[model samples]
Target: MDYMTLKEASEKWGISSRQVNYYCVEGRIPGAVKIAGVWLIPKDAEKPIDGRRKNIL
Candidate 1:
């Protein structure tokens, strides 16, 4: 499987690297793995939806 660094994932997902790290740390990112203190995300992994958002009507 292909993998991407946290930075790449952050850029592609349009989110802060810190947030990606947090997601990885929190196990919110599926197929995300930590290697040598760095986070490796699956290249095909879809960005998780933010649960903190509320729908406005």
Candidate 2:
């Protein structure tokens, strides 16, 4: 399977790296693993829905 870095995921998801990290920490991102202080997200992983958003599908 292919993997993408936090920065790449952030850019792809149109969010901040910090938010990606937070998602990883919260287990919001499926198949996201942390190695050597770096986050590796699956290339095909879908962006998790934001709880802060109202009625966002």
Each candidate: what lDDT? Answer: 0.93, 0.94
lDDT of model number 1? 0.93
Per-residue C-alpha lDDT of model 2 across residues 1-57, encoded as one tens digit per residue: 899999999999999999999999999999999899889999999999988879848
Minimum summed lDDT over a 10-residue window in model 2 is located at: 48-57
Residue-level lDDT of model 1, residues 1-57, one tens digit each, is 999999999999999999889899999999999999989999999998888898889
Worst 10 residues of 1 by lDDT: 47-56
The residue ranges of model 1 lying beyond 4 angstroms of the native Cα positions read none
Model 1 clashes, total count = 0
Error of 1 at 33 (Å): 0.5
lDDT for residue 10 in candidate 1, whole number 0-100 = 91
TM-score of each: 0.91, 0.91
